[model samples]
Target: MRGIQLSFNKTQKLRLDKALEQLEYFSSKLNSNAIVTVSDTIPVNHEDGVLKGHGTMELEGEVVATLCGVVERVNKLVYVRPFRARYKPEIGDIIVGRVIEVAPKRWRLEINFSQDAVLMLSSMNLPDGIQRRRTAVDELNMRTIFEEYDVICAEVRGFQHDGCLHLQARSQKYGKLERGQLLTISPYLVKRQKQHFHHIDQYGIDLILGCNGFIWVGEHVEVKDDMIEDQTNKSEQQNNKLSGLASHQNQEHNYTPLELRQYICRAANAVRVLSTLGFMITVDKIMDAVEMSTSKNLNIHEMLGAEFYVLVAEREAERRSSSSKKR
Candidate 1:
């Protein structure tokens, strides 16, 4: 869906436009006058010495927007949240990023931010789950932990004094993602929440809703319960490894089932449709779209059809309309 141009027939185009209009109407009712465009001066108490946030800059002694977006002010801090743009990181946000450059003492990731984010080796635990100070040998073996192009999950550790965004992955759940599909959507669609990691029990899959645009749909991985292994368990595990090393390796390489793979693609397609329709993507709505396809017995390939797109747009319009009335 990223580069594909979808063509809609006349009837489909009109229907889609109407549905989008309704959706826009409902959204505009919430903040119709707050929208501003490039170089537009933000309405603020100029005497208060307002601190400008992202998407804004102080030009000629006036706080003017640098992009087209909605204006927000918190106390004396004012910023513009752009409609369609790269992710703006906040501290403690769970994110999925791809390793771009394994730099010295740090692994730089492309988190869809204005600049790439860095995850320092000193900031993360070793593979053995130790928190000791990183040694020279550890720096030499950084690639062994995370090579270029590896998709990983981590949390925001906030910006540094030098203005670099740092990330941390001290938890077992945060590590290299394997045997999964990565999908990118609008970052604003994903609001920060308490839980971004979701396990779909029915499909035996894991869905990570990154605060950034990247999403991961993969086979469910049972999180390792213990970070520090006791001597007894280590001994048992070593004995077990000695008993059947090949078998253990085979188990580790177990392939995903065909049925599960199909479901993953189906779920990914649901996300694609939602993104294309400009709808706010959430786990519940994604599951609903998947369930709709399942109930209708539609094939995975058919989920991207023009008809399905129209249906999703219509469904969202009707849903928003109903919720508005209930309020």
Candidate 2:
């Protein structure tokens, strides 16, 4: 949250400090820090037969935390949730990753986890809208589907026998992401929810909240089965028709309206501001911040200014305070 470097004037710094202090007070009162760091032994009722969970190890008959995070207890089960660590993928988690290698029958992705995730050619829906076993030709033409360095969205398909993660993009909503700004934030800030894909129709933007902390803000693309046709069209293009088709293609896809681009940037900057404040990122919170900036007539570029940050902090403090009261 405060991991990002920011500049603030004397007054702005004071305002930020006060707002943060208020936030701290509210959070401290609500959550009494059932937290521990590495090597800290968690006090448990041994007579109840404590069972150690992930992030805990029995050291000298004491349950010691192996990570730095909040401690959670459920009856006889005890575990810690790491505050700052690599993303741990769970079954059905939506993730965003970059393709690192296109190997035989599978593509390796860097998913911000300990090991690279595997996207088997068969695990994903092909452009032809057909479901079948992936053939040898599919292996050879894997680049046509996903090239190296392409950013993709998928769900956790579980781990391989050797411990590498596996992913699946079996639906239209999951695939190569394009014409979007990819944002990186701490994984802890993104809480799991019933929905991760958000379409802000007001701005024509689609926001994907990856459990692994990769966020995409981009113009929404209609889900269609035209990917194969698009690929075929690309391969068939020759220098003879390049000049004429280039202009058409550029006019169709390359040009994003200035207004839409501004909106995208504005939304992206709102996310940055929230992340910088160390707040939990949710679609509602992001949209609220964006709406606030819009109501103030703040330009997209100005949203990242120090004054806006202080304003956002104050807003967050007030919001949290009210929320705590409601609870």
Candidate 3:
């Protein structure tokens, strides 16, 4: 019942009746039913007896039907049917993501997909009671508002012609996340769900469930408290340690939060052992370049549901820039 047959001419239409005749030569037709499907697009109507492209015909008990039209040609597997479900991100879809890199115009987000999506600076809403075009200063300060490792809620702005998705958070509910652990899941699963982003109101945990197989979660109270404590500690530690070092150590290290996250991801994955632990491990050590390299290796791109290479070209560029400035 399962076999492959080819059509020789592009102008011919492999009608149901003609297909049955060809099939009859291979198998008996007595007490058998047949169904047909065109594996490729045929001329609107061709009278030639020759079959064109590929097609499938099925015969079951007493039922006979043709599932026709253009077919996907990969191997030879043909379906005499259509898939009932398809995956596509829609507007207002709530997704969770990790900041992968920040360029001048936008932030590249690794939404756990083959292509990292983009969130443009224009898509972000101004803080409450402050309305003005985002200036260079605002762009530079962007990281101060949303740093690397910060989880955020956002809406799907739409997809680019090349299939890259764009996200925007213009409302109070869509910006600067306070708490939650991000969970990555398949984009297909997110598309199938009635609600893409789920607020864990019951558990009182904020979460951004990205369609790209990335999710962010944090404990509400702890995130805020820790952020403040971490900032103070970082300043104190930097001052105490740098006092003993040369003034050259005071060079500014500027990067968007997303860029930092990308660096951390790369560094965490570079470690031989941690590379196998997967992408969820957080790398907090800021001073060790070797650790950062190991982490970066683990930040693989999830394209077509498979793990692919991570986007580290930007990280390399940053490193070169930093080195040049130091010299």
Candidate 4:
């Protein structure tokens, strides 16, 4: 017989036998009887009544009596839950991603979960400076740098507030990767690491494993002796031509070697600064930082010429003004 019972509050007390009698009378209309017996305090709500077990009769809140019913078979296996959230990228996580789009300044990478990651122009190392305008030849050679469907190991810089991850590859260990078979895997399974570059010694290949699920593999090989001999012969011939041109320039301008070295050093430093920051490094910004270290009043026009430095200086001034306004 299965029946429902209500337990009295703490201030109320009634004999169990009397309670059972009242329950039977109340449940008779439903064709059930309250079976009275002892039971352990199996936790039941105030609506629950006596089942079969021996337990205490003390009631602090509400007491309820439950009616006994026929026993049914029970299943005992534990259940597992499923994950229900999108993937969140962290620094140094390995991921398998695909190139979705490419622009002159950046590449859009689909990392397989949320929004695509951006690989900025400053994060790459081209033969010329970042500001060097591309020529027709450069456009033809663009694929020599990176092409569509090419996979690379990239580091996650950070994520936008809307959850887009930014990527960078300015180190020698990264950029212009070649000769590697790509691998794909689930982003969640890839473990985050401190460094993105790693050599798979067991496989005899260098792997740039990304936390976004991208992987690049390349084999170690040495240049052949015959190829080195031919390259050396060609380089010597070019060196002779360059020497003749240098002598002509020296006689015409009397340019000091020290001045030339200074210009090269400044340009290299500017490139390094921009690469490290993974953003635009205008000429004025570079000149400002350079001027602070030198006693001489350096002419920006003389250093970088008129056209190039003018554009860079304008950008730098704008950046400074915007920053100052924010502060």
In order, candidate lDDTs are 0.87, 0.86, 0.44, 0.46
Candidate 2 whole-model C-alpha lDDT, 0 to 1? 0.86
lDDT tens per residue, model 1, 175-209: 89988899998898887889999999998889999
- State which candidate has the highest TM-score: 2
Q: Which pairs clash in model 2?
A: none
Candidate 4 lDDT by residue in tens digits, 1-327: 011123434322233334334434433533322232233122334343333232223345533223233111123211111111236777655454566777666677777665788876666545322324546676556566666776655667787676568887644445544444554433433345565455533334454545554444455323223343345555674675587468756855753355444543444343333223222333334445445324345452333332223333344445555655676
Clashes of 4: 24
lDDT of model 2 at residue 91? 97
Order of candidate numbers by TM-score, starting with the best = 2, 1, 3, 4
Alpha carbon lDDT at 131, candidate 2 = 56
Off by over 4 Å in 2: 36-47, 55-67, 224-254
TM-score of 2: 0.85
Arranged by lDDT with the best first, the candidates are: 1, 2, 4, 3
Give the poorly placed runs of model 1, Cα more than 4 Å off: 1-4, 37-67, 136-141, 161-163, 226-248
Q: Positional deviation of 21 in candidate 3, in angstroms?
A: 41
TM-score of each: 0.83, 0.85, 0.40, 0.37
Worst 10 residues of 3 by lDDT: 302-311
- 8 in model 3: Cα distance from truth in Å? 54
Question: For every model in order, what is the number of clashing pairs?
Answer: 0, 0, 44, 24
